[model samples]
Target: MLEVIGLSSAAQTLYAALVERSPATLAELGHDTATAARLEELGLVTRLPGDPPRYVAVSPELALDVLIQARTQQLTEARHRIAQLAARFHRSAPEQDSANLVEVVMGRQAVSRRFERLQREARRQVRVFDAPPYATGAAGNAVEFELLARGVEYRVLYDRRAVEAPGTLATIIGYLGAGEQARVGEVPVKLVLSDHPMAILPLRHDEHAVESALVVHDSTLLGALSELFEMYWERAAPLHVRRGRLAEATGAAEARRDLLPLLAAGLSDTAIAAHLGWSDRTVRRHVRAMMTRLDAQTRFQAGYQVVMRGWLAEP
Candidate 1:
């Protein structure tokens, strides 16, 4: 881990040994003078004058702070260079072939990093078609929360399958609570569109992993994607947290009200129960009661009644 801050593997090992047992002779730590000298140069170890000089590990809290600062500055400079290169590329894009508008990013890590960078660079909003053969198991986007805090809007359209995936509905609910505008419907592809002039969609050669992605920069293609999102958004059912007087209500009314969005989103009882942390039996009971109360004979009618009755109001 210390390699990220420019420490060699050997130096990191010597530093760890010194940290565990400090003020020891290099010979005792099984390290040569060169390794100890490297650590000392990095300000991670101190050499004291003695018959056979011993090295003391510097306080990690103090030593690592300087290294971290230097690393941060380096990263900042790299970002500047990347910005310059991107600007140059954009300037030359018009003279290049139309094929240059789509850049293929290969490998899972590369795809994931580009996705994160796209979201991070968004100036106004991000629209997503989130279906997921996820590159990472992480269910939530920490970058999204940061963007939300910065007042960047998020409009995410989740496929029903994505919502039904383990722990996904709960995570979606968390994003909704954080002011994301979310809806549930059929998402044809896994896509992310930022306010920037680019959009990314994962290539579907492998269904189990996001091994590659295409970053599209063509204005016509981007406009089509934006229209596609709107079309889906119009058909998708909005998802929101239960709130206001209904939230403060008690008993079956509150329970059924809480279940409205899940029903509207067409989740099965088991999926809804998992999302709400309720037993399967409890979810079934509520669905039956809610249907009876609405005079609906089927789950579909019951969900329609929920919307007609305006039970899924914004929180």
Candidate 2:
């Protein structure tokens, strides 16, 4: 390590010693030189034949200038190596931000930040094809609210099969009531995106799958998506269709119908909470209430009774 910074010192000592003695043994060449080992380690001297001892430095005084040249070469090689390492890392950069195109962002936070920036810049409208099953949760909703509050025109398309949670439905209606246009329909894929500046996340079913996000801000691309969303919106149902269900059923009943089977399959409350976007306490309460409703002493018994009653078999 010290060899790199001490190269100049090492070169000077080796050359000075050689200038004094044309040919000398290793001991005589750098008898008491601090950098003797460093010079020999650098191949600046050679051992020669002699009974007592003999060593010859590679070059004499005038040509000993090669030491400085060698030093320059070493510095150049070091800089080139560092530059190559920097270039390699540059190529591995996650998102490529360019003036005229969408940026590809990797990892969760970067993707979310790009989406937030788009929402902040939006003016005329914001159109969405929401794939709730792949939703990024609270952080995403906060950004949605931010855009809606700015009076940006907002449109969302939701998958019909999404198991809507309590406040989630209310939130949607509230957004729609505030002039945001929302629609629900079935889609073959799971994703959430908007026009112009849009973010997308692929559906992931594996436990170890990485979450990826992308944001596109190009105007032409945004316009094309806006048109596609408008066409889909024409055939989509409004949030009002499902708002009634939340009012008619208790939260426990909703949980019983939706989460009982998953719970019985040995999923923990946290996993259920993450999947359904419900609080752990809420999930636990629902489980306890279901146990009482079935007159069962435990969750296992309640699950057994639920299946026995054919509720599990119902659509």
Candidate 3:
């Protein structure tokens, strides 16, 4: 673990020994002078002037924190440099070779890292085609919230099937509450577009884990993906949070108001029930009441009525 911060194995072992038995002579710690010197340079150990100089291990809470902070700064700088290089490469690669526009990233961790970097580097917006067979769990996407808080616009188009997946509706609702412009529709592919330059799409659609993906740079393919997102976004129904007068109400009224977006998104009754933590029968009752109040005979009609009345307005 200490190697991550540029500590040699010998130095790490020496530091561990000193920590376990502090204020010990170098010989007593079973490490040579060079290892102790290295640890001292890293501020992990201190040497006292005595007949035979003894070393004291610095408290890990303080010493390791300093090392960790330094390492984090170095990594951040490295990432910035890599981003610069990537931008330059993307600008020049197309003229040199058209095939260079799309890079293949292999392995789940690489794909996940690429996806995160793309989002982190976005200056304006992130457009996503969210569907099933995800490379990663939706719950682990804390980065999206961070970006949203930073005023980065997020436009996410959730597939109907993705919305109906177990525990996914609640997650989508959280994103909606966080100022994400969300919609539900038939997504033709799984894609993530950052600004207008870069996009990523999975290479495999099997039931197995995602093993590979294509990272598309500024190219015709990327422009087409951006257009594809806009096309679906226009056709998809916008998902909104329960707000205004309905949000102030309690019981069935508020529940029915909350149900409008889900219904419009074409989510099943079971999906809505799971998200609201209500029984299926109760969900059905509220749906029927809402339909009757709207004077609509079907769920689709009820959804249209709510949108037309502007009942599900954003705060």
Per-candidate clashes, comma-separated: 0, 3, 0
Could you give the C-alpha RMSD of every candidate to the true structure, in order shown? 16.5, 19.0, 15.4
Worst 10 residues of 2 by lDDT: 240-249
Which regions in candidate 2 have their CA more than 4 angstroms from the true location?
A: 1-100, 138-140, 163-167, 188-210, 219-223, 241-246, 249-315
Q: Which is better, 1 or 2, measured by TM-score?
A: 1
Cα deviation at 72, candidate 1, in Å, is 49
Where model 3 places Cα greater than 4 Å from the true spot, the runs are 1-95, 242-249
Q: Write the per-residue lDDT of candidate 3 for residues 1-315, one digit (tens) a residue.
A: 779998999998888888899899987866799888889999999999997999999999999999999999999999999999999998997688777799999998898899899999999899999887766765557889999999999999999988877777667767878888888877988899998579999887766436799999987888898899999887677777654121222565467667777777777888877766777897798888888999999988887887788765633
lDDT of the candidates, in the order given:
0.83, 0.57, 0.83
Candidates 1 and 3: which is better by TM-score?
A: 1
Put down candidate 1 lDDT per residue, 47-90, tens digits, no spaces: 99997998999999999999999999999999999999999998
Q: Write the per-residue lDDT of candidate 2 for residues 52-171, one digit (tens) a residue.
A: 455556654333455557778999999999999989877865345355355456665565565566666666566566654433554336666667777677777765444243345455
Ordered from best to worst TM-score, the candidate numbers read 1, 3, 2
Q: Which is the leading candidate under lDDT?
A: 1
Scored against the true structure, residue 61 in model 3 reaches a CA lDDT of 96
Task: State which candidate has the highest TM-score.
Answer: 1
**How many residue-pair clashes does candidate 3 contain?**
0
